[model samples]
Each structure stands twice: as C-alpha cells, then as structure tokens.
Target: MSTKKNNPSALNEKAGISPPEIISSNAIQQIKESRKKQPSSQELIDGILAGNITALSRAITLIESTNSNHLTKANEVINGCLPHANQSIRIGITGVPGVGKSTFIEAFGKYLTSLGKKVAVLAVDPSSTISHGSILGDKTRMEELVKDKNAFIRPSASGETLGGVARKTRETITLCEAYGFDVILIETVGVGQSETAVHSMVDFFLLLKIAGAGDELQGIKRGIMEMADAIVINKADGDYIKKAQLTKVEFNRALHLFPPKKSGWIPTTATCSALTQEGIDGVWQTILDYLELVHSNHYFVEKRKEQNQFWMIETIDEQLKTHFYNQPNIIQLLESTKKAVQNNEISPFAAAQTLLDSYFKK
Candidate 1:
C-alpha cells in the first residue's frame, strides 16, 4: 500500500469527475443554531409586548390552535397580554357577499396606516367543506395593505364556528392590541347571524352595502341592520357613483327608522369606492366621531363591561355543553338514547334528562 495520503480532488481529476461542493463551517453552525429550542411562553409574551410582529403572529396561532398541549400556553399568553390589551379601537365590519368587504378593508386599513396609525386586520374566511381550512385569500385581495409595514393582516378560518368569525378571534384581537396596534378591524364572513357575534365583541359595528341590487333590504336581516353603527355603500366609482349615492340616502332613512342606539350615537351612511380609495377617510372619521361620543357619555366603558359578561356566560355555556357531550359514558349513551326517543320508547325530554343525569353522576 502507498504511504501517501489520498487526494480526493486529484482522484476526481484523473477520473474526469468534478469534486463535490462543501458547505462552509459558518453555514453549518447557522443551521444548527436555527434548530435551537422554541421560545418559552414568557419569551413570547415579552416579544409581543415589545411589538414584535413574528411573536404576535405566533401568539395568535397558539390561540387558534385546538391542540390540547397548547391550551395552557395559549391561556398563559392571553393572561400575560390582558393587561396590555383593550387600549386599541376594535371595529367590526360585515357585509353580504359581493359587497367588497376585503377591498374596503384594504382601503380603510391603508388610510389608517397613512395617518400613522398601526392597523391590524383580522379577516375571518369561510372554511372549505372538504378540507375545513380557510381560503385565506383576503391578504391577496389587499395587495397594498399587505405591503404596509405598519399593517398586520391575519386571515382565520371560521372552522365550524357559527358566527362567521374564528372561535379565537376575541383572543387574537387581544394579542394584536398588546402588540401596540391602535386600530383593529375584524372582517366577518358577510352579513347574517355571524354579524351578531362580531357585534358583541367590537366597539363599533359597520355594515357594507351596495347599490341597485334590486331590493337592498330584502336579503339583510333586520337585527343585522340594527347592530350596525354605520352602513357604507361601496363600489361608488364611475357609473355606480350615482347609484351608490342614492343607496346612501335610502340607508340613512332606513337607519333613522331603527330605535336609537344605546350609545346615543346615530348611525350614519356614506359611499366609498375601494377601487379608487375615495370616501374611505369619511367612514373612518365617522368611526372616530362615534368613539368620541361614546367615550364622552361613558357608554363605551359600560358596553365593554357588558361584552365581557356576555362572553363569560357564553363561555360557560359552551364549556358545559362540550363537557357533557365529550364524556365517555355520555357518548356511549347518546346513540342508544336517540334510538329510544326515535322508537317512542322514551320521551325526548326524558332522554335528555337521562343523558344529563349520566353526565352529572360521573
């Protein structure tokens, strides 16, 4: 055997083969460092309060997670953020399909950022039946706002939640506020009962409408109109401008017919063109004026208190229902009980009582 050390490059050159490239030691060290342990909950909290967008996004993801392992961490994060939250203005925006909600939100969010306001948009997209995942197309629709450094847009899946909002939306809002966003816009999945859920959480609820849609009032629920603090007619550019103007007048009249709001602020109507970004500021001004009016009368504080209580009760109800349905014994009994009720062997009320008794006894 030869005593000389083997030279891989010399051998490759003799064989007419190229030598393999090598990764630098620095790059190897960076890759190892990148795989370091994830930040603790306190680290996440500190980052969030320090206005770190990545931290904030991670915190919101935790809140939206259904993983049992994440529940405690998520709650701790929310608790840590609670003291820093609720300082921002929360606005709920809803509309019927084709009302251009994403377009308007982009325009409105851009306007707020232009005024040096840090804006956060929480858009709730309808979940797909097959995958049960959000399309998350709002960010694509809001091309301009997506590029704004001062703006944060999070699109969440409705995910079997009845109210056209993600189940964790309220918690997500808290995280955004803690991250120092001054203006938070929650975009619902169009107008319906989901609007009521959004109305309960937001300070000001805005409904977007369009013109020349035959009967504008036909599709919208009466309760939804009452929930609105303002109704905006979008797509007001060019040929639609006149139609939008007319619709605005009609909406103003319709608003007057509803009973006065407890906030003592009259809901107003305006038209805007999200395409041209016109009249966007007017809608924002209306919101600011309403905020001033409510804050002055102290209704703003009271309303938040009411919302807190409402969520508390709602949470209790949900938990109780979840607990009852999730019990092993209850799960075993449900099918048989349903059959009993179906076959007229037991009354529906009696069957329900049996299930409740089983749950309580356990």
Candidate 2:
C-alpha cells in the first residue's frame, strides 16, 4: 500500500494528459474543472483603471491571440475598457537596426517618467525571425527602462503576420491608456522603412537615421519620408556629430520637397546621441509641440478616428485572406490553379476564377 493516506490515484485517478479519445465528456469535465478561469471583464476593466500592469498585459495578449474562442471575451474586455482609454498619446518610431531606436526610447522613456508621466514601449521585431534565428532584441537594449516602475516594455513577438506587430497593438495601446499610461511608444521593425503599417496607426510618426552616405538615404524609401512627422539623426556625438548635423539639413531640405503631412504639420529635423542622452529632451519637446498644434486644430481626434476605421477594414481583409487559403479544398485548388497557370493550361484570369469559384462553392 502507498504510504500516502490521501493518494491522488486512490481517489478516482485520471491520466495527466488526455489522449485523443479522452477528449470527450471525461476530458470536457476535467477541462471544466482544471481550467483557470479568466478574470471577468468588469474585473479586468477595474484592474486596468487601477493601473495594474499584469492586467494590462493579459488584456493585450487576449487581444493579440488568434484563437477564435477568445475573440468574444477579448471584445468584451475592450468594450468594458474603452471608456477608460483614449487618454494617451500614441507615437510611432522606426529606424534601421543600428540607429539606436532602443537607446533613444530608453532615454526618452526615463525622461517622461521623470516628468510624472507613465510610458509604455512596444517594439515590432519581425527581423528576428530571419534564417539567423535571433531573438527579438529591443527590450534587451532598454534593460534599465524595462525595469522601471513607470514603464511597460513588450517586445513584439517574432514572425507575427502583421508586420511583426501583434494584430492587436492598436487595441493594446487602448489597454495601456486605460492603465493610465500617458504615452504609448510603438517601435517598428527597422526594415526599409516602407512601413506604412506602422505609419497608418499612430498620431505622430518619427523616423530615426544615422549620418551616412547618400546610399543610406537610398536605403530608406521615399514613401516613408513622406509619412514622417519628424526625423532624428541619432549618434549625433563622437565622429558622427558633424555628419549628423549635415544630415539634418539634408532632411530639412528634402522635407520641403513634399507637401506638409496630412495633418498640416511640418516635419522637424533634429540630431541626438541616444546613447549619451543628448538632445533627447528637445525630441520630446518637438513631439509635445506637434501634439499641441494638431490638438488645437482638432486633427488629433480625427486622425485617431480614421485610424480606427482603417484597422476595421484591415482586419476584415486579413480574415478573408485567411479564410480563402485555409479551406482544405481551396488549398488543393489553389495549387492546381498555380500549376495550370505555370504550364499555360489556363489563362491566369481563368485560373483565378476557377479557384475562387471552387473556394466559394466550398
């Protein structure tokens, strides 16, 4: 006999992990019994309103999850939390990998905290999932800021479909707002900077650059420059200092070639050493001044409203694409259609029609 008086096995033992067949009533009951119930939406709302970071993180994860089952609960949480949101400024920042985006954010975030404001830093790091298999490294770069009490730092998960940003980053921003974060900083994967995905979502868009040859400017696309509300030349100390200033003048001239941004605010150029924390305050002041100008003109409110509408449509488009490819028959038909097109058995137009017809019929 076992020495334990209350042997778990003695009391109607069950397997630790259910087998496929056990996924019926027995497993259902076990799931019902063992499941850790999520906090009620009201409780989540209260927790967010009270500035509970754990609750804020959980809420964001719920919004980010692609599980169909959690969407209803996520929406409930959003609905309950909505009234408490929209209180913070959402800013988008992007730069190439070595341009000191993390350093800049850390310094800027600390400075904001000193001003009695809470800041949240979220980074999109899709590049991490390249063949190199590196981890998302933005949070690591901001080690000190990550540990700060007034800051919330989340690294965008690798290989996320939506530009490495969780599909719910926009929603997460609202959740952070409910938790009393006065500023929400969204950092994008520093790719070619044709990141309209990030640009479409934020009130203020900042592009970070390093002083370099004309080739560096060519590396970043012109489309992104048009979207930038400000451009900061990072690494503005040391040997790069003079070059950074020259780059600023170059950008200022370039900015003039395009019309003012949709909000009618002229983009400003500045230089800073994010590593040394020089001119960081000036960057923040530029952001604040831009906000003040836009807010007075009512463009701030309208911009967010338009972003919400854009997200709504974008979500629908994504879901439709997912649905199109996920249907079993549609996958088969799509492959066949591809081969047909490649072999010229069918015109591209006809092949597409056949695939769409099959998918819709299914």
Candidate 3:
C-alpha cells in the first residue's frame, strides 16, 4: 500500500500474473456515440456514388427497414440515387433448391471481378411465414466472393412476397447500380413465381438445372423455362458430365416447344461445373451475345420501359391492398367475415362487398 502500483500491469507483476487489457469507459462511450449517429440522405448518396461499401450497406439496411421514419429516409436515398442507376446489366439466376445456386454465383461473380468488372450478388432467401425470419446465409456460403473487394453480396429475406424475392429488391438493384457496379446478379429463392418476378426485373434471366436428380425436369415449372434467356446445367464435372450434356440436349428440345420470346432471341442451354470453374466463360459469353443481339434490336430499351410500367402498376396495387387491410375496421371485420362465410351466414361475395364498403366509408 505504501508503494502503490500506478498501473494494472504493475499490480499484476507484483502478483506474478499477466494483466488483461482493458478498454477505457471513454472509448466505449465513443463507440456507442458513433453507432447512434445516423447519416443524412445526401451523405449516403454521395458515399454510394463514391463507391463506399459501408455507406452502400447502410443504405440497403435503410431500404429494408420497416420503421416509418427509416422508410421515409430510404425513399429520399432512393430518389437521390435514381439518376445514377439503370446503367448496369441485371441478371436473374434461379433454380430448384439444392441446384448449387450459391456455388454457381460465387464462381460467376469471381470470374466477373477478375475481368475488372464490379459485381454485386443479391440473394433472396426463403422466409418462414410464421416467424417472418430468414437464415440469410448466402454471404457465408459464398466465402470467396465475400473476401473479394470487387464483389458485394447481400442476402435478403423473401418476407411475405410470393415470388421468392424481397419487396425492396428492385430498389436495392438501383442502389447497387448507383454504386457503379457493372454487373448485378439476383439469385431467387429456388423455383416458383420468384422466377417470374426476377424475370420482370432483370435484363437477362438464367435458369440453373442439374442432372441425375431422377425427375430430370427437376421440378422447374415450364413457365420458368419459357422465361429463361439461357438454361445452364450445373455440376457438369467428373461422372456427371455425360448426364449434363444429355440434359442440355433435352432442355434445348423442350425450349423449342415454347413460343419465341419477345426479345427476338433464342434461349440457349449449356453446361458448367461451378466447382471447377469450367464453362463459366461460355455462360458469360452467351450473356454477352444476348446483350448484343437485344441491344441491336432495341429490345433491351423497350423491355426496361415495359418493366418500369409494370412496376408502377404493381406498386399501386400493393399500396391499395395494404391500405385496405391496415384499416382498423377491416382488421376487426376480417376474421368475423371469414367465420360468417364458413358458417354460410353470408355469401362470399357479400362478405367481400361489406368489407369493401366499410373500408370506403372509413
């Protein structure tokens, strides 16, 4: 006590033990303050245009936020970034579950970055309807791309959206494009109407398939195939090579049965081994060729215009539905109306009319 140790390390030395490093309270306070600080919308837009990954990530989080205040900020950010978007090539990739979508995207994104192209991978993960939560594990699965500075990977929950894509994915794409990403890859939540939703948003749609899965058609709907600009057979290596080739031929034949796409381009089928990085170039080349073909025919611009119009109408419908359901009277009546219909106390059409009338009156 007479010779007081001024430092914890000195006291540890007296006790013949090593001292654990400690952070000061002031340092912790600084960190808390930094985290609590929210950037202005203009700051976010400037950071995004400057290619700041942190700002881009924060902007996306804002877009995904459910809070009304955050949504207002997110809309402001979107408006700021919109002028800089629509410059990148947007590609939608979809397949049945277990079709190696994560693997293929990792390989494809890595290849694109090697060519000096900035790539962004947006993954839509299936969410539990009961919990409304998703695993959000695509970034973990795509380990290599996660380490690459040129590649940005984001995994979003599908929420209640029917198409296996997040409600905010289109806006996210705009933000990615604004960040100067040359290529945008949207991975849908396996197979379903998600393919159609993705097809509506992307410049090119790629359907991934695998062989030796018994069904061969692989549970992929015929409608999804019709939407594809290219069908790629994954796992085309080692013993599966022959099976992949046969699958390619089968897909080509099947694609011929559908009417031609409005793009005036024929859909092609190819094989690739994402594990081996084999034939990845061919797939990219096929996309390039399609781009050239569509641009030459002016289909690319026209398709984008059509997509914009489609989304506008879609937004209106969604808003109207949300407005109708969020009304207090509708929420109170919804369960009772369903019960009445089930009990045959009221006709289904009459129940619907009553609900609509209540909503309009409110």
Per-model C-alpha RMSD: 8.2, 9.6, 6.0
- Cα lDDT of all candidates, in order? 0.88, 0.82, 0.91
lDDT of 3 at 290: 100
Q: Between the candidate structures 1 and 2, which one is better when assessed by lDDT?
A: 1
Query: Candidate 1 residues 224-272, lDDT tens each?
Result: 8889999899999999999999888878878878898889999899999
Best by TM-score: 3
The alpha-carbon deviation from the true structure for residue 345 of candidate 2, after best TM-score superposition, in angstroms, is: 2.9
Q: Write the per-residue lDDT of candidate 2 for residues 1-362, one digit (tens) a residue.
A: 67767647665648795546635788788789855777877778888888787788778878877787888888898888888888898889988777888889999999999999899998876644557344767778889998889999987663545666535777788788888889999998876432677777788999999897565556556788888899999989989898999888888888888876768799999999888989999999999999999999999999889988988898888778878888999877787789889999999999888888888787
The true-structure Cα RMSD of candidate 1 reads 8.2
Select the stronger candidate by lDDT from 2 and 3. 3
Judged by whole-model lDDT over C-alpha atoms, candidate 1 comes out at 0.88
Worst 10 residues of 2 by lDDT: 125-134
Model 2: per-residue Cα lDDT at residue 272:
91
**Can you tell me which runs of candidate 3 are displaced by over 4 Å?**
1-19, 217-220
TM-score of 1: 0.88
Which sections of candidate 1 miss by over 4 Å?
A: 1-36, 164-167, 341-347
TM-score of predicted structure 2: 0.84
